[model samples]
Target chain A: MSIHNVIQVEGLTKKFGDFTAVNAISFKVEKGEIFGFLGANGAGKTTAMKMLIGISIPSSGKATVAGFDVFTHAESIKKSIGYMSQKFALYDDLTVKENITFFGGIYGLSRKRIRQKSAVLIEELGLEKVANKLVGALPLGWKQKLSFSVSMIHDPKIVFLDEPTGGVDPITRRQFWEMIYKAANQGITVFVTTHYMDEAEYCDRVSIMVNGKIEALDTPKKLKEQFKVANMNDVFLKLARG
Target chain B: MSICVANISKSYKNVKALQDISFNVKVGELFGIIGPDGAGKTTLFRILTTLLFADNGRATVSGWDVVSDYKNIRKSVGYMPGRFSLYQDLTVEENLQFFATIFGTTIEENYDLIKDIYVQIEPFKDRRAGKLSGGMKQKLALCCALIHKPKVLFLDEPTTGVDPVSRKEFWEMLKRLQQKNITILVSTPYMDEAALCDRIALIQDGKILEIDTPEAIVKHYPKPIYNVSANNMYKLINSLNAYQYIHSVYPFGEFVHYTDKRAEFNAVELKLYLESKNLSNIRIEKTVATIEDTFMELAK
Candidate 1:
């Protein structure tokens, strides 16, 4: 892990109307580390991601993503980071290559650069066969890979993935992680949220969110050890039950 | 009565869903139809419940042929679809009663069958199904499905969008439900859940990849699995994958789940190969493969 943090979140609080969606949570993602943001459904994981990505504002406290303030420097932070939500981010009706071009353009890439990046991204994701195919026609696994590749269109310093492999099969998920690993190898820090316990174990470190708070954070091995459990599932069970 | 499906094949417009899929569920058994999304599980479930007809072949649940005895099958089986299609405007209790009434039964008649699950959400009985949480909705749906006292139960990805704790609770409820002699045919994409079933059929791309008891499936795995990790973890995984003897390698947690070309290969030799590749801090250990591992092997 790098000494300098890519993401520094402290006492972060987010509220919607009257409900406190995320309560005073704190954590830091070191540059170049695949940081696992772990939580169950409605555990406020998505809410926290939205705040860190600058889509939703924090109710109080401070959060800087990719060395830019999430509140004041939102646009600059957005430029330095990539994000893939739990829901499909690509338009279903667009061709695979078209989705890539669209996202690249939205990120302010020049047409020439978008074309060049599109080719590299498509080739890396093995989407050459389906470049012209509608994203809806591609398998869920393939679309997830394409979505992840699209997130890094501008070669951002950080990427946020929200359950990137929700419904993908084991083989496809295994392959998806290969792409994540490829990105992490290139010094791109990954901030991903997932309910999948096994996927948590793949991260360099993980933070378990429950009821709008981060209850646990550590490497998967250490979390297992601290909980005296056999796997990440047991660790999650312990934290969730509490 | 046993449930049997023979040569079942169905397709939507221009897409073949099930292609000659065959399987059977023993009486009082908890059977699982395991597969990724769009692997024809829903179609098969619909065929067995007599809602949709197969383009070819036959299926019977509890001694009633789905085609010839459609009404009887509908009366005798419970189905929780992949998507929650319950009347959103209806209260939880209303939904339960509606399903029971449709099957020509009453909640009082089968109250004992669903008491445990129903009681969990009793306070919200007057709440609209759409207003309930994902876990509560699942509970209410299950109660409705069981209200008719069906001899068989078919749940399509019952734990799909729920929390982990609720998923565990749901599976526990199924175990208790099995005590009442109801055979279950459940479909799930999560391989970890596969072990809970009495038997599982691994499906992929509209084909039956494999079907057996979870234990049997794990025992049948042909490769000697090694989970190895090292510094420069990404490079280690890539290097191990690029090894001459590496048959199939995929990332599994902190380590790469690798199987060599030779069954007789040793972990020590594999470790040396990593060293030869100039990888440092390499730690390799032999590990027993889980259902997820077996599924990856089958699918790949």
Candidate 2:
């Protein structure tokens, strides 16, 4: 019930028939915080995210996103949050400008506001030259940036990014984190999942999931200290080995 | 040399995949080709494995020519491509048997070479390859590749989709294989894994930027870097970028990796500059360069 907490969950669980994909996990995310959700493949990170984002119903638990109950107000939660999946969600065939306008329209943005926002976004991302270019023709790094920008076109209160910088070079990954920092600075809660341990260090706090359960959750530094490891990667190895 | 490439160039239509790439791997050495996607690591692997011919180059694998002695090269090399190419419907045991039979060998004949990996997957021997978890599938793939006891093993992005724990275990297994005198050539986009290899080549835009040990690569970074942060990280990056005395600035996790234009950069002066801009909670300190920092410096 904390006013500062943008997301609150208690005993959130999901099951696929007899298989429990997400165990009774609980966590609270404060407004404008970058929350890192770390887990291995098939560790139920995606299923847990789906439940929090209001796309998947939990079998048993209490959850609230942006002050709305996940079960009763999933529609309102959807409108208040933006999501970028592991796969690029923008239309590849659409031009940079068109993709922006399209996503903005889907969020109930008016034509005038969409046009103004598109201009500012293109300029900010250094995409003015390729504003009319098809997204398919852009490099992977540029496409990722554009997709992230499009996701935030409506200025949602929370953004969920899944593996935003997969396969990108170090430089691009660094720049992408800047964008996340920028969003969080403007009071948007960012819930992200990534395999890269270095990215875990960027989070204000991180939760490591193992076998459908959250094995550890804390600031990266504290988790590293608790596990007697030098970095988040070693911390993950220690917890996952258990 | 266990493997060698000279003046290798490859292109498909209008796009250049590799440009004048050259490197050598010694006997029993673990060599890593590290780069992002579209960096031509796969193309280089395909050429050395004799699956694809290079447009211009001479190469050898285990002292056999990649082109003229391709058949001999194939016999001496184990290649696990980027994708899982095993029979999805087939069980783990069947896949191992199938690979061994194709190489004109039996599982029992080369069981010693794959005993460690095979034992882990043996409990699930009857499970379909596709039904196994990411880590289990990788173990099966490694076992299949080692059945014939090939002198050289080529693994393309073996740990890409696997979890961090499995990734650590995979590298440990590779170290054990190294003790067996197998020359391992692995490619991955992960910079952290580069440190695990004996020597690594950082590739980008189809060119090898640097080839050396991970420690040596980090030592080669020619600048004093600082980790800088403030309350407004986004504005801090922009202000740092616009600063007159800054050489380069890029975000690194929670802080920015910064280098000043002056050789003897003053951390206090940088802090004062941020304070002058009304930024609070400022923290700046000299930080050691990592393999990733070195890669970015070289790529730039």
Candidate 3:
């Protein structure tokens, strides 16, 4: 059965003055599904994602995220969705627990809920010993994992992760995906943008953006066959060359 | 005797960069510190190269402690930071000469060590380092690092921005470097590159998850995999994933990789069923699990 659509975009376009960052494009994301966004560096993936997450406004086109209009309901959309950026998104001076609390507070989570969530998240992430430790002192992997958990602290219906696994090891990437699966199983939709073509293969569906246009959108397997390529990398090569 | 890290723990104030990290790189071993940007690979490389100090552990390279004998340790090791930190105004040859002078050596004396890497970019030696392409810059950087003939080399995400073909050529240079019997500690976020390393330390945050040969790690992967591909791939993946018997339906190449969801589901029946879907010309076959798959399996 086709998954119910949770994210809808009709002719989404974003123009930065004269240049079009994200051209008129359209796609939909299903509720509780893992949607991967793939593109090369400087491609419109980030632009399109920023528009969808409400950080960047679209010049034209309409979008609804989690059943809320991305234009007028930007605040409510932000409330219902979590975001993890490409750069590490935690304060280096704060302790592990403090970082979680800070993010939770921003999401307007109750102090009690923050405390409870902190306890569970810390234990689940194997960060109990580092609860009082400063986040800046933590390794890249731990910080990444913690950042991920922090993004979901408020139980947002949708989460936007931007290259959350950029320089992490294979093991950490795997663990990261597991966390994604756990969230997906819990019915939280995941929308992630990444440059790594292989990582794009992990998504239930992926859209490839090039030159502000979504040239290809499909499951990884279909992309390879459609492009007459061996892998997602080849699919991207073909799309980029075109 | 070697590069040894014991119980290293560090935090950046709000982020944990390394947690009880420990490892050893022997002479002549091409050891890879595999992880994403925040995985503490850079922090560890910095600590080992004496660029950064560890908070709660001790590490020694060539018998010089990273914290105490930092100067001595720095002198004996070559380092290529994640970002391009070389002098951009200087020409390619000038940068190499400058690095050589710092280590009390001359480029002529060590010409053989970097000949393979340097020759390709020799034509641009007079060109400023800043103007070179990503691949050429990489070559110059490697040449500069190896000029001193250091016993150990540290490269942090050296292939981040280069093209795939360039990346392959860079790795070939690394293999040649290893033949010179220098211990190499390199970090990369790409999973496919992990297989090329003789041994790797899979790091995240600040912790060491596993240290083993790449082959051994893959040998430990426990999963049965199948490949499925057809026109309109996204719909097929959704359909396959919805099936009760399909466990995982990830895209691998020109095909979607499907596994038995129920664990006991047979491959033969699954192949027939996949053909029944809108997908055609299914190439359903059992294939070897990759490092990424192994990582997922191990992480779970």
Query: In model 1, which runs have C-alpha deviations exceeding 4 angstroms?
Result: A1-3
TM-scores of the first chain across all predictions? Answer: 0.95, 0.98, 0.96
lDDT order, best first, reads 2, 1, 3
Worst 10 residues of 3 chain A by lDDT: A166-175
Tens-place lDDT digits, model 2, residues B8-125: 9999887899999999999999999999978899999999999999999899898889999999988889999999989999999999999999999999999998998889999999
Error of 1 at B254 (Å): 2.7
Candidate 3 Cα errors over 4 Å, as ranges: A1-5, A10-20, A59-64, A67-73, A95-97, A110-142, A169-172, A195-198, A228-234, A237-242, B1-31, B35-78, B83-153, B160-185, B198-300
Residue range A1-242, candidate 3, lDDT tens digits: 23477789989998988999888989999988889887665667778887788777789998988878888888888888999974758999999988999998998989999999999999999998899999987766788899999999999889999888766655566567768867887889999876566677777788887888888898876877898877777777677656
CAPRI-style docking class of model 1 based on DockQ: medium
- Span of ten consecutive residues with least summed lDDT in model 3 chain B: B247-256
lDDT tens readout by residue for model 1, A1-242: 23489999989999889999899998888877999998777789888988888888889999998888888998898899998974857999999989989998999999999999999888877778889999998888888888888999999999999888877888888788888888888899998877688888889999998899999999998998899988898889889977
Each model's TM-score, in the order given?
Answer: 0.96, 0.95, 0.64
The superposed Cα distance between candidate 3 and the true structure at residue A71, in angstroms, equals 5.3
lDDT of 1 at A91: 94
* The candidate that achieves the highest TM-score relative to the unseen native structure: 1
What DockQ does candidate 3 have relative to the true complex? 0.16
For model 3, what TM-score is found for chain B? 0.92
